[model samples]
Target: MTDSTKYLQALEEFILLGKSAPGAAAVANIQKCISSPNCFVFAELLELPNVQALVNDAEHKKWVEALKLFAYGSYMDYKQQKSAASDSLPDLTDLQLTKLKQLSLITIASTEPHRLTYPSLQSLLDIPTTRLLEDLIISAVYASLLDAKLDTANQRVEVSSTAGRDVAPGDISNMIAALEGWSASCSSVLTEIEAQIASIQASAVAQRKEQLAYEKLVEEKRKTAEKDGSKGKRVMDHSDNTGFGLGEDEMDLDDGPFDDQGGARKSRKGGNKMFSRKR
Candidate 1:
């Protein structure tokens, strides 16, 4: 069910067929494999003993080349060869052509993850119209060759994912380099995430310290205020209990009320008693 093996059963049939096929029969088998709607991966099929034998056969060597084109070459590769030597390679079936273009799309998307503009694909695949290109893209999506959106507004194909095609011997190095670049990008992203988390944690710690320090300052001020209030209360208590803060001109409570003559009231009472006695 994996992308690499999605068409594996169909390919296995070709392998089995090639076992009994001989001479030109092998070339026919290759043709069937390439033209099969379900078959996409061809490295295994190409390596079969019966199929490889076509390379030595003068009459069928071109069929082997045609198969190679399906396995790894793009649609542009076919066009170039057909243009240079019209009969050098076997003519591709419509289905075969469509499949090759789909595989080529995978190659292009892998190299450039974005920027699948309609114009670029049309130029590369020699597709004549927007409708044909869109149909091909939609077919590729349904075939599970790629996961992409048709950005009609943007006039582009936004590829989110793609299946791998058979890697030619020369393509191995490019694949490795791409993997290395991806690993480095992932490492950089991880480092950035770690730095952001550290910054957030450090900020949280600093804020906590500030909050604690502010609370400590408030507690200290409260204790000092209470202590100062206690000292003032003690001073007032001392002034009330021992007359320590009294002024010299302040009256004493022990003296009696004064009379109109500026004599003590006790003297007025005594004069009233004397007058009463005289009466």
Candidate 2:
């Protein structure tokens, strides 16, 4: 298996065996495990029933409570627990103090919005002075636990982002469910977009087909009109040629089949004879 699997297996064995066989070795191993970079492992170990049993045992009580503070509790929890205890707690090493400060920031981030006031954060961390708190925040920022801006004028810390932590037991399923929901939402939007594109494409194709059909009809009408116009022009030309000759023949018939001078003389003689007969 992978290194993570091996580490987890090793951690599980330690937690299970350490409960039945509590000693300097087990406490040392526990200390080593909590000091690991993986904060979730420390959190997971804190949740064990056997680990909680260490609270009653005077030898490992301080370590158990310290681990709890790193897991989910803030500096306030550490202070409060220390106040209630009859015995004196062990002094925190430099490394443990740094880790506690980091964990305390995480706890604060969980409750507050992006902007966190210096006073409130100082109260939670129980730092002696503002300078120390600022230093702690700076260190946490350097460790990449938080992305924050210290607004001295406003006396607030503005957090823009935070790094992801390890998943607690049974949290993986919830994370998967959230991811599946997001994927489904994205798929739905994609489907709607695809449908809209198909609709637009269909409309364009129909319009193109209609335009082609109209153009074809117009072309056919133009050809038919040209043929009809040519036929009508030929008929008009033939009628004009025939009408010129026929019109002259009709004019000659109207003149009574005589030359122009002879017709006039005969018409005059006919008029004289009619006059004599009347007399």
Candidate 3:
């Protein structure tokens, strides 16, 4: 069975039993249901016709109001009611008192996770010391009422989570406001994350464009260098051809047969002879 199945089943058992029971017997059923350690909610039992009849009874009407208190009111509320009209309210057993105190932790610690200070809870629950307060908090934790730890150094109860209680009268508006505030905070954080992602993408695109431009410039310079080198080689080849032709003509005259008078001469079979006189 589920964690709350047994508790609700026990409560439902009482409700069904009270339906057929007489007025006084129904009151007894309510008392037993509230006093059970497993049971917490009493709204259904409170609505029974037989149970409601006790409201008119002067002696037993207190049981109806007392069950309402256990269903919605905190332990502090119990104390206040008991103080005001001790004669009219039904007495709570040890289990009922302890359970109410645990349930009261949910109310006091609901607004903020870590807002309940040692003095505040102690005063509300009638706990005399921080040690006793811690024990109560531990008991509530063990019962799955709330997740909390004692902040001994700070003298506070730092609550992390709590079971949701039945929405008492006057709580709907506050709950809605709290939900709206949380939604707004989440939206703000999401926008910041999206902005950061956009910035990173833009930076990457700019870097890629810069890299491509640099590569294009380098390729152009390499092509220009190769063109200039080819043109210089052609000019060198032309100059070498012209100089070679001129050197050959000079060598023919100088290396030709020399006349007896020590003068230079160039002999050709098909053309006239050329001679150079000695200086």
Candidate 4:
């Protein structure tokens, strides 16, 4: 049967029990707890004003315990209570039984890790056989209470995920505190990463500047060397031209009639040339 239908039926049973006010209040509280995130019906049921009001009343005490068991208590809890006092325990209908099993599965998921063995589940569910336990788990999976894998070979159920339930009192505060801590940790990590990146970038910039300076220095040295080479070549050329001019002048003075005696030598040479022409 659908959960809503079962709930309505339970509500009607409560009304028939002559405790409509508290019964409806309890059921409403259960519904609210089931709908809220991370909330459990067990403690929430106990905390209900109506349920609490029934606690001291000898006549309605059974109904309060019944609501608690119906909303959250497991078959084991029921069994234990029945062992203690059978007459005090409320009889569970088939729908309520199914709901109890489903809620028990949710509790298991919340309290335990991913993988659960068949024997362990049997202990938790108080089921008679492995088949019944597997059937219950399968039903829960089909109802979308759990995302799981049934390993028949290994005799275990691997729960991959589960939905969140209503939050209990103080649960929100605890969650907020945990989230704040996580946020602080993330902020610290990000700060460290940013600092490291900044350091690397600065180092890279410094290295690039150093490389550019070195290149500029080499270029300047190259230009200076070229300038010095050109100057040396010009000086050597001038020296070679001066040596050649001096040698040519000495050769002309020694071979020709022109001596070191200034214009007299030049005039004597001209007269000799004229006499030779007349002869």
Candidate 5:
């Protein structure tokens, strides 16, 4: 429903299609998407570890534009001249030139030595299936990193696209091994992060419990003080009523006569009588 969700869905569909599509169609599709401005802008701002992973036929063109704009600057025309002079094949064909161009776009953006590596792109210019596959993997990994979605454990350090396309058992084994290696790396990093979070949570819980205990002890002390104060007040009131040393004039008793014979006193107003006894 949301724009972001729509884009994400589109991206997922595109990825699925890319995986199943023939290599030539996949490259074309990815190139077309990369050429669009929206995809280009998104790739630029993405913070993932491998930015190249997300590019389809559409997104790769955007990256090319970025390379052209910021990396190329005013020396765009000179790139071919430089490449021709450095490259072994001065008479490289049109197809080779196109491949060189693509490689130039990528190498300029990459950390590898551009002058030395552009020739390889030149070498693979005509092949629609194999070279493109290598580029696709490279692009996917790069994009994933740039988009903040790249898992290092999923990285294939020695991924070579030239392996036979028939899907042999050995190929499957190699693929599984590479993927397992990548997953292990990712799992280790994830575990470390989880451990740190758990430690912090435990520390916070302990601190809170200690604080509660301290507060409870303070409350108990306050209650005890109040009880002691009340009891002392009661004792003082009792001592005052006994008239141990104070004169009777200081007392608030009503006018009443006590016989020397110590006879009982009764209320004359009603049958119910209220009385106090002196020590």
Candidate 6:
């Protein structure tokens, strides 16, 4: 068989295997089909690797099948190499194309095509988004089969090569105009927001300064009160000392604790003589 035919066959078989309830032989077949570089591909295909033995088990068989599927597809497409651009590129066979067209028609009938709709046709295929992106990137690739067809048709219609060779000039102009208009509005909004932010920052700074000033005033008041309190204590201490400084007041002769200094002297002499006689 031609390489193309073999690739087409492998693609269909891979899709079939992808949907099956996984077993060792089935998983191994899938691995052989896909040629997985890591266990993750095996894990994903089988849905779980718990059944696969840790060291070397029959689960490796699943990976073998997966590898075969992967290899067959990869060998056919140069564009599918070393990239996550699966959605961008599609390896659709004639039968697959027919099915896809039918699916697309159904989608259009049920949903608006030009209303910025997401692709529902892919969901029907149960295509992973990773693969979908790959296909889209491949589809959008410069001068792929689809674009070549368009370019060929354009060349047939237009005598001049320059005519419609690039994006339509008017379309680009309109897009630029829209961008400029949006940019002007965005710039104004940004300016207003910046002004508001600046005002808020200034107000916060002023409030902080006012708070600091108030704190300072309160601190000064506290210090002054403390100083005044200390001074009052000092004055009270001086007054107490002065009151106790003088000796006990002498008894007044008139009050008769002693009649006079002479009487006090005679009493002392009598006491001394009495003490001597006793000795």
Question: Which one wins on lDDT?
Answer: 1
Global lDDT scores for all candidate models: 0.83, 0.67, 0.79, 0.64, 0.43, 0.39
Regions of model 2 farther than 4 Å from truth: 1-22, 29-58, 76-95, 128-130, 153-156, 170-177, 214-279
Model 6 lDDT at residue 165: 13
Local accuracy of candidate 1 as per-residue lDDT tens digits, 92-185: 8788888889888988898765548999899899899999999999988988989999989989898888987788999799889989999999
Task: List clash counts for every candidate, in order.
Answer: 0, 0, 0, 10, 39, 47
Q: Residues 1-279, candidate 5, lDDT per residue (tens digit)? A: 643454455445445555555435544544444343223212222222233443443534343333232222212333544465543212333433343343334333333323223234334333255445455435534433122121235332232222111132345788799899999999999999999999999999999999999999999999999999988863333355455555433534335633344544444433334345576
TM-score of each: 0.71, 0.55, 0.70, 0.58, 0.32, 0.32
Model 3: CA > 4 A from native: 112-115, 129-131, 176-261, 265-273
Worst 10 residues of 4 by lDDT: 270-279
- Clashing pairs in model 4? 36-165, 36-166, 37-165, 37-166, 37-167, 38-165, 38-166, 39-165, 39-166, 39-167
- Candidate 3, position 150, lDDT: 78
| Best of the two (1, 5) by lDDT | 1
Error of 1 at 13 (Å): 1.2
Q: Give the total clashing residue pairs for model 6.
A: 47
RMSD of 4: 8.7
Q: Give per-residue CA lDDT, model 4, range 13-59, as digits (tens).
A: 33343334475555454444334323223443455467678767676
**If the candidates were sorted by their lDDT against the true structure, best first, what order would they fall in?**
1, 3, 2, 4, 5, 6
Question: Candidate 5 at residue 27, lDDT?
Answer: 44
Question: Any runs in candidate 4 off by more than 4 Å, and if so which?
Answer: 1-53, 65-89, 170-177, 218-279
Task: Write one digit per residue (lDDT tens) for candidate 2, span 102-131.
Answer: 767866776566427888877776677889
TM-score of 1: 0.71
Between candidates 2 and 5, name the one with more favorable TM-score: 2
